[model samples]
Target: MTEYSEISARLAALSDDQLTVVLQAATAGRPAFWAVRAALDEMAGVGNVTPGTDVSPATAAPGVHDQVTGGGVSGQVGAASTVPAVPVHPAGIPDAPAPGGYSSGGVPTFESVRDKVEQRFGTAQGMGELDRQTPAGRSADEQWEAREKAARERLDRIRKSMHDNDTP
Candidate 1:
């Protein structure tokens, strides 16, 4: 059979998705299926066919225009214009910190780190009492050891603060 018939048969056999891809490729200038269509028309002795009625002789193709004198069927072309610049502020307003930093009211400050730590693990003195081997104490030996280590660290920080103040 002829190449046209073979191509037509292949197109007929294409799946819907394949047909869509073919149509998109044809619409874009890449594969140029219109060139093949033109060739087929020439083989059938039909000259170039222009869609719809012709316009003024001075006009170029449908969307295309004569760029020589910067004037076309559309309009005259000029230098590309740019968008206006936005005003700048020197002292930028600070944005509210993220949700984790504030309560629902949109304020940004957080509780002191020591306050947060104490909230999570009671007071350092309370933790030291829990670490004691009293009958009422609830923590395991390892847990008590860990809590004692934390309490000692907190005490060291307090002592360092006292020493630094005395130096002045």
Candidate 2:
């Protein structure tokens, strides 16, 4: 007999409990087998076979109907359709409007740039607040110095270990 026929004959011989276990194993490995598992679970429930051990199938995969009708996936399905668009400024232009209605030939002054940065990031108070929040108050230069010192200390420790080994 062919493989299909042999498999069918074997399946036909399995008790309802054995079939339920096989269906659970198959569905657990692959979500696509969920539908078949669900049907088997319902059948098992009605037949009162392995009633205590019955496992319900996972929810169905999201479908086109879910997307259009907004019914299937709960919170994941019903989010707002469109996000707010980002405001755009003209090319080679800053996002802020020109100060005093005066354009300085499109070249922003250092003070203007500093003012803009401070406006967005706040004054020295902001920098102080950020520094206080961080574990170390050191700036970029201080951090680099700390890293260099740590590397040198590590190298010294390794050299000491090697010298001790050689002397012994």
lDDT of 2 by residue, 47-75 (tens): 44564453656756546633333221223
How much is 60 displaced in model 1, in angstroms?
13
TM-score against truth, every candidate: 0.19, 0.24
* Candidate 2: pairs in clash: none
True-structure lDDT of candidate 1: 0.54
Off by over 4 Å in 1: 1-93, 102-114, 120-123, 133-168
What lDDT is reached at residue 13 by model 1?
73
Name the TM-score of candidate 1: 0.19
Q: Each prediction's Cα lDDT score?
A: 0.54, 0.59
Pairs of residues clashing in candidate 1? none
Q: Give the range of the ten consecutive residues with the poorest summed lDDT in model 1.
A: 66-75
Give the worst 10-residue stretch by lDDT in candidate 2. 81-90
Candidate 1 per-residue lDDT over residues 7-118, each given as its tens digit: 6777777644344334443444545577765554443334565555464677766333312222212323763322122222234655444457664456645564545776
| lDDT measured at residue 31 in model 2 versus the true structure, 0 to 100 | 75
